[model samples]
Target chain A: MKLVNSTLAALRAVRVNKLRSALTMLGIVLGVSSVTVMMAVGGGASQRIQTEMRNLGANTIVLNSGALKSAGVSKGQGSRPSVTLADAQAIENEVPAVTATSPQHNFAGMQLIYGNANWSTLVTGTTPEYLTIRNWAVSRGRAFDREDVIQGSKVVVLGRTVAEQLFGNQSPVGQEIRVNRVPMTVIGELAAKGQSLAGVDTDDTAVIPISTALNRVVGRNPANPRAISGVIIKVRDGANMASAFSDIRQVVRERHGLLPAQEDDFHLINLTEVMRAKEDSARALGILLAAIASVSLLVGGIGIMNIMLVSVTERIREIGLRLAVGARRSDILGQFLVEATILSLIGGIAGVVLGLGGAVAVERYADLGVVLNGQLSLVAMAFAAGVGIFFGFYPAWKASLLQPVEALRSD
Target chain B: MALVAVSDLTKTYMLGQTAVPALRGISLAIDRGEFVAVMGSSGSGKSTLMNLLGCLDAPSSGTYHLAGQDVLRLSSNKLAAVRNTSVGFVFQQFNLLARATALENVELPMVYAGIGWRERTRRAREVLAQVGLSDREHHRPSQLSGGQQQRVAIARALVNQPLLLLADEPTGALDSVTSDEIMATLVRLNEGGLTVIVVTHDAEVARYARRVIHFKDGRVVSDDLNQNIRAAA
Candidate 1:
C-alpha cells in the first residue's frame, strides 16, 4: 500500500536472491541488446542511404531521348533523338524549377590515341554544367567554360580512369589525344566518383564540348543537328520536383509539337525515387529486425515468472507471516511484482549500455556505419517493464491467493 | 458487548473425497484485556477455532462477532482488513523476515496498512522498545537468539495496536527458560489492557494464563479460571 515500503521491500528481496535475480535478468538484457543493436544497424543503413542519395543527385532529373515510335510500333532506347538542344533550352526557359540543364551526346567504346598507345572508353559531349549537375568536380586544370563550348574548341576533359589509361602517371592536361582520327587537347580531368549504384565505374569516360560531337562524330540523325542523347536538369532546392518534372515535360512536348494524342519521345528519370525506395526498404527491415528481436524479451519474462513462482513456493511461510500480520492480498502481489520489475529494469539499463557500445564498436571496427537511435533505448526499457508486468502478474497473483493458514503450515 | 462472541460454530473440510469435520458446535466468549489459553491435541480443532477467532478463516456455519462486527459473512478482503485492523497473531516459529532488521519487521504490518515510512518507523521503534528490544532494533532475525526472535515477532504483533493477540504454540520451539521470558512479556502486554490468547499443548505453559479452555475431539471438555495464575518470575 505504501510505495516506498514496497520499493524498499523489493530491493531487500532482490538483494537476498542476488545471483538468481541477476541470472533471470540476463535474458532480458540480451533481448534489449538485440533490439537496440538492430535499430542502430537500421539507423546506420539510413545514413548510408543518404550518402547514396547524395551520390545519385537527389535534385537532378534525367530526360533521356528515347522511346521512339514508328507507325505505333515503339523502337527501344536512343533509337530516336527527339530531345534536341533546343528542347533542353526550352526546359530551362519555360520550367520555373529548372535551375540548370545540360544537353549531352555520347559515343560509347571510342578509341583514344596518344602517341602509339591507345585506350578505348565512352566519349561524352556536354557543357560545363554537366559536371555540376552530376556532382563531379574537375580534379585539375579548370572546367570548360562558355568560350570553350560556344567557340567549338577541340578540347576534352578526361575522367580519372580514362586519364590514367591514356596518359599513365603523366598530367593529361595540355596534352593532345586523337579520338578516332580527330585530335583534341585535354584541358582538365574530372575527379573520381567511385562506383555508381549500378556498380558501374563512372570515371571510365571522357567529356568534350557538345558542339564538337555534333560537328565531328555521329553528326546527324532523323532529328537533325538539334538532337541530343539526353538532357540532365538540376532542380532548385525547395522546388516541387514532381511539378517541375511535369512542367519540363510539358515544355518539351510543346517544343517538339507533339499533340495530346501522342506520347513524348523522351522519358524522365527522377533519381530521388530510386533513393527513396532504398530508404523505405531499409526502414522496413529495421522494424522487422526489431520485432524479431523483441520476442526474446517475452522468453526473458517467462524466466522471471518461473523464478517468481518458485520463489512464491519457497517463501510460503514468509507469505503466511505477512498475511497473518495484516498484509492484504494486494500487498503480497505488489511485493512480488516490484521484485520482478526491479530485476528486468536492471537488465534494461545494462542492455542500453551494451547496445550503444556494440553500435560504436561495429561502426569503428567493422567499418560499417552505425547510428544511435536515442528513442530505442527508452523503448527497450519500457519494453522490459512491460515484460515485467505481463509475466510478473500471474506469479504475484498466485502468491496473493495463498491461504495464510496452509502457507504457515508449510516447512 | 464482549470483546468476542460466538454461537454455534462448525467447520468441515473436504480432503479429496473425504469430508473432515474439524470444529463442531463450539461457542465461547472472552472479555477485553483477558489472557486466555486454548488447549487441545493435534486434530482436536483448537487450531481451527484459533484461526476462526483470529479472522484468518471463516466457519462453515456460525454466527460470530468480534468487536461489534459480524465477521462470519465478511468477504476475504474485508476479513483481511479486520485481521489487519483488529487481530494480531504469533506463531510457534518466530516468522520474522530473515532479511529485515527488527525495526523493519515490526513496520511491515503498518506498511500493508498504508502507514507512511516516517510514522511507521516512529511507531515501530516505540513498539520494539515496548517489547524490550530497543537495543536490537537494527539486528536481523538471524542475528538474534531464538527467544529474541520470538520477542521481535511479538513486537511486530503489537505494532498495529490490535484488539486481540492470538498466539498459536508461541513457545513451542523455545526452552522453558526462554518460554517463561516470552510469557512474561505477554503478561506484561495483557496487564497494559491488550487481550492475549495463546494456544499451547504444554500444561506448564498454560499455567501462566488466567483462564484455560481445554478441547478434545472437536468439543470443549473443560473451561476453568485459575485463582493462582503462575507468574513468569
Candidate 2:
C-alpha cells in the first residue's frame, strides 16, 4: 500500500510537469536506445561471423601452395604451384590421421554458354571427395563418379547461382553446356552457399573432375600435368585437428624434400584461426560501441540529476509543508527517489521498444544483420534503473536534510 | 496538567559566526482547550516560538514538556511522532501541495501516519465537510479562494485530531472579510475543545482568542485573559 501511494504520488508529480518531465526522460530514452542498438549490432556482427565460420567446415583445413621468394621479402600467398597431386595422395596414403583429401584446381573467368544464354564464372575441378570436405550438397541430379574423374570425362556440376545465370528457371540437369567451347554435361547442381565473409558469392562457380580440368582443359605447364593448386582435408569426427594438421604437414615436407633449415613451400590455413582473429576484432568493436553507449547513459543520468535538483529547489516549500504535517525525513527522501526511478523506468521501457525497432530497421533498410538478445535488453533496462538511483540520490538527500522552518520560509 | 509546558526555552542561530538569538530564556504554559493568540512584530521571535511549539524545530537549550512528557531531548523521529499525532500547524501562505486536491491535502497527514485508505478518505471528507467545503474537496489550491485555501489548511491541521493547532499568521494573506470567516472557523474548532494557538500581528485577529500573549525580542511581555473578547460575529 505504501509503494502504491508513492507511485501514484510520483506519477501525479510527473503529470503536473508534463513537458519538463518528458524532456528529462528524453535523455534516458536516447541513452537506453543507443545501448540496445549498439549491443544488437555488435551481437549481430559476432553472430554473422559464427555463421561464416560454420560455412567454412569446422574440421576442414586448406593447404595452399606457399609464397615465392625473390630476394629477402617473399611474394604473396598462393604465389606458386608448390602443392601437387603427389603430395595430396601421399598425405592420404601415409598420414594415419587423414580421413579424406581432395586436390582442387580452378579455371577462372570461364564462359559457360547455353543455347541462347552465356555467363562468366569460375569452374573448379576436384575429386568427388571435395563434395564431402566442403559440405557441398547437390540439390539436383547426381555428382560425377570416380570413373568420370579417372577418365577425365567432360561432366560438370553447376552451382545454384551459376546454373540460374546459364539456364534461368529451367532445370539443366542433363543439358550439355559448353565450357569455353568444350561441351560438358551438367550432372548436378550445388546448393546455394550464400556470400563469403569477404563478400564474394560462393555460388558463382561450377565444379568438374580434376583430371578433366588439368588434362582436357587449358593444361598449364604440360610437363607438370600432375600439379594441383590446393588440397582440402576433412578430419574424422573424433580425431584431433591439431594432430591431423601436423601429420599432413610432416608428410608434405617429406614429399617436397625440405631440409631442417629450409622452409616448406606450402601454407596450411586453419579455418578457426582466421575466424578467431575476425571474431576478436568484432568483439573489440562491440566493446568500443558499448563504452560509447554507456557514456551516453551517464550523460542521461546527469540530465536526471539536473532536473531533480531543480525540482527539489522548486518544491522546498512543499517539502517544508510535508515535514510540518507529520512526514518523516525518510518520507521526503522516498518520494523524490521514487519519482526519479519512475522517470528512468518509463524511459527504459520505451527505449527497449525503440531499440528493437531500430535493430529491425538496421537489418532491413541498412542491409545489416541484427540478432535481438532478450537478456541484453533486460540488462540495459537494469542499467537504466541503476542510473536513476545513482543520480537521484544527491537531490533527495538535500531535500530530506532541509530544515522545515527554513524551507517553509523559502519564497 | 498543562497541555504545553516550557522552561527557559532558547533557540540561537549562527549567521556566519554571528550568534543570532531568535529565542531567549523564556517559557510559558497553556492549558488544554484554550484559544491563545501570540502577538509579535517582525524579529520578535514569535515565529521561532511557534516553530518550537509545533515540533518543527527543537530549542537550542532549555526544556520543553508537551503533554507532561519531556520533548526537548527526544530524537528527530520522536519529534516527528509528536508532530504527527500531537501538533498540527497551519502556515501563513496556506502551504498546501499545489498539485494535490484539497481532499488530498487534508489526507496528507493521515498518509504519513500509515492510515488505511478507506478510513483516511472517509475522515478527510469528514474534515472537508466540517470546514464547509465539502463540495470543493476536489479543487486544487489554485482553484480555491484565499479563504477556501486557508479552510483547507485548517481542515488538514485538524484531520489528525491534534492536541494543539498552531497557526502562524493564518490570516495574514487574507482580506478582512475572509479573515473573519477563517477566525470564525478556528473559534468554532476551539469551542469544540481543541487547543488553538494563532500567531498574528493584527489586533482584530487576536481579539477572537480567549487569551493573548504579547512577545518582544523573544521575551513574553504580556499574558492575560481577554475581559472583552470579540465573538466570531
Top candidate, metric TM-score: 2
- Residue range A66-99, candidate 1, lDDT tens digits: 7767898888887887788888888888888989
The positional error of residue A192 in candidate 1, measured at the CA in angstroms, is 11
Q: Residue-wise lDDT of candidate 2 within B1-233, one digit each (tens)?
A: 99999989999999998999989887899999999999999899998999999988778998888899898778777777788889989889898888789999999999988898899999999999999999998999999999999999999999999999999999999999999999999999999999999999999999999999999998999999988799887
Q: What digit string (tens of lDDT, one per residue) describes model 1 on residues B163-215?
A: 99999899999998999999999998999999999999998889999999999
The deviation in Å at residue B144 for candidate 1 is: 1.0
- The DockQ-based CAPRI class assigned to model 1 is acceptable
TM-score on B-chain, cand. 1: 0.96
Q: Residue-wise lDDT of candidate 2 within A299-388, one digit each (tens)?
A: 866776676567667777888888888878877777777888888789888988898899899989987777887787777777776766
* Location of the lowest summed lDDT over 10 successive residues in candidate 2 chain B: B72-81
> In terms of TM-score, how similar is model 1 to the real structure?
0.69
